[model samples]
Target chain A: MKQDPDKSRMNFPNRALKWLVILMVVFLVIEIPLLISHARHAYFKIDGWFAFYAILGFLACPALTFLARGLGVLVRRDESTFGNEDDKTLPEDLDEQLR
Target chain B: MNNFADFPPALILLLGALLVPFLKPSWRSVYVILLPLATLFYVLQLKTGTGSQFNLFTFTEEPLEFLRVDKLSKAFGIIFSLNAVAAFIYAFYYKKSTQHVAALFYIGGAIGTVFAGDLLTMYVFWESMAVSSTFVILARNTEQAKGAAFRYIMIHLVGGLLLLAGVILTIARQDGSIAFNGFDFETANHAGTWLILIGILVNCGAPPLSSWLPDSYPAASVTGGLILSAYTTKTAVYTLLRGYPGWEPLIWIGCAMAVYGVIYALMESDIRRILAYAIINQVGFMVCAAGVGTHDAISGATAAAFCHILYKSLLWMTTGVVLYRLGKSNLCDLGGLHRTMPVTTVFFIIGCLSMALPGTCGFTSKNIIIHAIEHEHLFWPWLLLEISAVGIFLAVAIRLPYFLFFGKDKGLTPQDAPSAMLGGMALLGFFCLFFGFAPGTLYDLLPHEIDYHPYSIAKVTIVLQWILATGITFIFLKKWLTPKPGISLDFDWFYRKGAVQFYRAADTTLNGANALAKRTFIDGFVKWTCNFFESGASRSTAWLMTPIWMLQGHNAEEIDSLQQSIFKRSKRGAFQIGITAFCAVILLGLLSIIFLLE
Candidate 1:
């Protein structure tokens, strides 16, 4: 059966999962050395903002979650815009009501 | 050393490239090719010395500084200009006047960036590249091109804003002299620093915000992807070298980008996306090298950056040629074309080798970086880089060509690529092999001495063994590692999915707000006033206004009358009116109260 182009492209969720993993790695990687570097540079009077940035970096996860939920609603536009006749494109194996 | 004031005017001539839009299309191509050549010759003429600078133009309130021409900037400038020349030659046959104009300005911006003596100038040129390069992407005239280019521009523009803010803060704090200096990072105002890093990272394809490259590059026309791949990331590496060389977090960030890109490239079916991931991986090595920040490490970083510009561009060009001829770029849709396109096959194989295949340019340069890690004994980055090696082998060395040209045939019989495209690939491939055979020119371009030898017997043997082991491992585990169907995810999903989700959620919330704004405002005020008058009004008033009471009322007038009666009886509205009356009484009574209290 030919795959629906819309469903094929909706490979959107898969990319989201991958991005989540990559970002998790990026966040941790960027932080570890920053913390260590901050620890090493103790003699130099550390500004309060580095600590603030560190906190913000850690907080980006929750922020990203809220942001993601927000964006999902925008990307998933209403399905009916394409057309009204669902029966035309329905597969042979499918029940008519499922369409 | 030439006098600081007597330096070359090459950038000025190139900067006039703002005029290409006014020229004819035929004239545009010549202008594009000639402008970079002109800029290159002029950059070559700059006098070498400390404190050598040129005042180019003035911004709205600042001097547009250029011609700094330090050793660090010189290497980058030369490489950037060389990239422009090669990219132009490859793009010479491209008929789009906008691409030519955009390419020229993009090159100008890169040159202006490298030579700029101050932060403001760097930023001005930085933004120019953003605008011009975006047009280059849009010139592809496809829906994907339009979308990807828009995302690309938006990311860079955000970066530019951050960089501009950083520059403004740095200058303001330092009393307006735009001399470059290392930040204290702790005591220094880091708002600017973080903004700058973000700005640069967006270009560098850092994680969490790095989806632009893989999302966009594959969607470009053949030659367009080649030029696209070269500039943005390398400019970012250049920015880090100039601004924040030894920031240790970058080492780990670079290592992650390296490994992360390789993982995604494994799942990518598009040839250009694979190459785009490879670009991230290559830049990861350099970023890690720069993070290490030793003189030798920096040299390795410089050499890696230089070689990457050569080899990665070559790889993309090869992939571009394949895509151009076949009319499709999906790995699953490609195979068995080596029979017809032998020259392209050779060029592609060489490009794969240069992707760190043994005895290729990637071998020499990547080894130098790994050796620096060994020298420093940085175990974690070293280990991740080593593991990443296997992933790279799987993605580029085995999977890329294997699926595209040697796997089960997709029955595609597209003719051999146009000679022009093949010529470009051959030229780039020749450079890869030539540089691999002789690493001297690359070595000479490094800012520091090359005490570490890349071609030693022990190093070569070790590199060869590793490559051989990876190759063998890939063959045995090819099924597990190489899936024919399915695209893997990367950092870009944030922009792709996260951005969409956030926008949707925001859209819904905003829509809800728009729908309920007046109700919320009125209800909030009424509720606050009801609270304010609680002493005067009985609790029954509050209960009656509740929805249950309103439902019990059964008629609209009854609920409205009940609410209006409550408002009339409540003292809350009269409090404001009576306050002024009380204040007047207080003034009249103050004299008596003072006398009475006394």
Candidate 2:
């Protein structure tokens, strides 16, 4: 079963991801005409631009991700010093149980 | 004031909670539920005017407005009391009397702070909230919690001290007119006002102090965490709206908080702590709105705070349920709970949507703040708020739920949360959608009448686009965004590790000085005096006896030898009793002769 899951993981671009990409495309298409009306209520000139918020949103998460990752040097620390917080709660053979 | 009708509604919860420990569980549960329910009704029906005034200070003509009822205070009071009821339901089965009482005090303190007409009353309730909530953190009963609770109280105590100093200074300067209002520029620029702002900002989880919320809240008991997530920071937001509206510095501060919260929350691992950080992000919107300080902006801040409490508490309740069942809160340890805890899963999604997607209270309330920012033409803040909003969606609405519920199934199978928890979540979840669909219901509760309709097609579509775009990005970046089994460092480092270092340095420096003092005074000067006294008797006796022996023509060498022997013996405390007694007699006889002459 583990090998089967690993083999599946080796496969590129699963069905769920493919479906998500398709959904994004559809959403972008639907957002286009609405953008005209959205632009009318725009505060800045950029709001009238093509999918400004969508473009902003597209990069925003990744930007934040990279930014956080860069700052991870400052933020993250290894748990090894404390050694296995989950072990305190989990059964002793939890790894075996999983396998 | 004499009539029961005019009694402070907050006291209803505060005094009513005192009887909890004495009551049996069944009665206690019912009583806890009824107390908040009664307060909720009372606050909702209260007219917009100050009453329950008392002249605590004879020097000042103004009496403290104990029950200051207005649109802003009433709105907060209503939600606080309502959440109190829901929290009691959630805690009904917790069975810890201390947790229940602490939760009540926390809620009452929040409500009192909301309705306080003056800085003094507000500070009292503010401190009460601070202290009681510390107990809630202690309710977790883990060593990590004990440490976190200590740090939590330490930060809040500092904040409280700042607030107290500011209140006293401001009140004293104003001839003891203790009424709370937005600080004007002359007042705002001063040391006292700045201290007050810093104090309130500390509680708001602004920079350098932002880590306290996440550090502490996750360490609280499940229900206590929910109660905590609902109250502390939101009260500070309310106070900001009341006192520091239009302070231009707040705009920058709020934006910093907005982005800071998102980035840190995204980095967090413990699901409850993740939600805890998200609370700061949500409060950041309100804080920013308070900075915007227009009529609509204040409304936006107030509305955001109100909606935020419901949705955020619902989120906490859902996560609380997860934490309760699994005995863990980290995402690395939790997954596929959607299958077993379907109701909780659904509620969790509602909470996520309420935070990000359209047609939820998150959409409605957040839009109001964004709308205020847009109308005010604040470009940079608007940009940061937008990006932060998307980041929030990705982190909480998308990342958190996907991993905890829908991700790969773990081998572990924990049962669903108890019905009481589901009931609490459902209460808030219903409102999350209710207000989203009909924002007019919420808009009417704002401090000022707002013509803002949050469900514009443009707003809805933009939120939808961000959701889809962010959702796609999350899928692609899943591996990168997945948290490792570690905690992110934050400013709490100052007190956590730095305080230990501080204590060590202090210990070394202070004790080093103490040791030096001991050596210089006791050993060097005092010890010499001790030795002088110890040998003085024998030395004096030898001197006296030698003089007398010389008068009798005894040999000088013999007298000198006797003096040396006496000195040596006395140094070791080996002086003969006879010689000492003889010396005392001779000294007495000499003193008598001197006295007779006198």
Candidate 3:
């Protein structure tokens, strides 16, 4: 059986995602060893920790994202939140005021 | 003209700004670009030493130094003029001459501040920079632009005042020596330096007071925003390095701002707003370096400022081109543009050199600062800087490009940037790669002779690790990191809502007191005095007749009748002659007694 072209096109995102994940894995496989050896001469002792930045980056993204989401829940506002506030300088009856 | 070499490079741009509108549109555009290039040549000609003096009718005990071309000033002047050219080139196609004039005046002020030798001279140009930058924002002419410009100038005026206050106080204590130098030892603890430090910090957009930058800058015209970014904060960094190096509070303030910027940027959805927040993040590193205050750290700071202005301009211009073409810059509204706008996408990718990715200008410039932090073993600050690094990289390099350029197609097809825009972007892109590849060229311009190298294997890989982690996490957790279509509150809420609240409080207090004063003084006491003057004659006449009536043995009713008759006559303005005479005699007698006593 042959696949429909439009359906395959729809699957492009999935396939691209799979390939991106694979490429990142390849980079990681190489980076882990390079990072460990380089940590030997590092000034900060934390760099000596295994996969320090990778781990930091991995942990940081979700943490900051969720944190930002929490902050967004607290401070996030409609685009119009500042509209009325900014327009306070303009009189309600602008024509009358201008007159 | 024999001493034409003594001319400050800033004067060229300042004069050019006035003449810009007179030229034809085509010539005006050419003139703007040529002016900055001329500035570049003039700046490069400035040798390392004090230049000329400008005495203001014996204002100071000695002639004030106006043109100081040390390595620091020279480095800043060179980059500022270069970016000014690129900035003007980016705007070459726009027809409005006012924006060009504002930008020229703005760049002139920044360059002047960089070269100023004395505190007074620096302050004059510093404030001029603020005022002119406001015009740049105002050129947008939108209500939002107007509001932002108002807030921007208000905060900058405050910052300028603080700088002026500090300069005055420091001069007073130093017996009128107004030279710009580091406030250290006893001077470091003085209130004067603290004021100066805070003044500079406000311009650096440090936290709490930091929202003014993000609040106002995003509302500016696209090119205006680009010009706004390059000069104000970097010049503040210059003043900071010259005025309060090794000021320790900046370490905490800088680190806080770094994290604050990334967090806010992570939350922002507007493409320009995100970049505005990113400016604070980048300047945070420079501010930290200024705090470290070592010779190498100053070098690191100078290098970072140079590269920052260069790469940040590229970032702004590339996004600006997108904005110009599409009329939309919100992350939610834009996606999958790479298929259509490939060149801009590529330029944007190059501009991400600001993210400190491997082989980008950020890595070269940022490496010097991080290395300085580690050499000093400043652990907590170092850790915070790294964390900020992770967050900023994710926000800009990953989240920004992914959503705006390469995510789900929004079915919008826009042509790539105009060639003129591309030409401008290419100018900056070349510099980003130029400094990235040949970092030694940048290093040679540093103020100190630091024996440091940026391209060590260890140094390169660590930044690589950050990118690797930033990429992987962003890919997997892309859902959480997607920018929602909304704005987040910052400290500006205080000034925005809070400025209103402040106005309300002031109104209630001031006006309430005014109304109360009217009630007590005007209505109560004043009316009483007025009544007394009008009616006192009748009352006094009746009282004086009581004693005489008793002496004449008149009955109480008869006496009262007599008194009432006299009072009624007096109310009609016809007091009986005898009673009136008695009262006048008493008043005259009292006056004569008072005179005799005196």
Best-matching candidate per lDDT: 3
How should the candidates be ordered by DockQ, best one leading? Answer: 2, 3, 1
Is candidate 2 or 3 superior in lDDT?
3
* Evaluation by DockQ, superior candidate among 1 and 3: 3
What pairs collide in candidate 3? none
Give the per-residue lDDT digits (tens) of candidate 1, residues B412-492. 666666665666677677778877888887777677777876665445544454455455445545564443444454455
Runs in model 3 lying further than 4 Å from the true structure? A1-28, A32-39, A85-99, B1-5, B185-188, B509-513, B516-598
lDDT by residue for model 3 over A15-97, one digit each (tens)? 98897787568667747656556534656788767667767777877888888888889998988776643433432111121
User: What is candidate 1's DockQ?
Assistant: 0.02
TM-score of each: 0.71, 0.88, 0.85
After superposition, which runs of candidate 2 have C-alpha atoms over 4 Å from their true positions? A1-24, A35-39, A79-99, B1-5, B186-188, B536-598
Ranking by lDDT: 3, 2, 1
**Against the true structure, what is every candidate's RMSD?**
16.2, 5.3, 6.6
- What Cα-based lDDT does every candidate model obtain? 0.68, 0.83, 0.84
What is the TM-score, restricted to chain A, for candidate 3? 0.48
In candidate 2, position B125 carries an lDDT of 93
Rank list by TM-score? 2, 3, 1
Docking band of candidate 3: acceptable
Question: Which candidate would rank higher by TM-score, 2 or 3?
Answer: 2
The TM-score, computed over Cα atoms with residue i paired to residue i, of candidate 1 is: 0.71
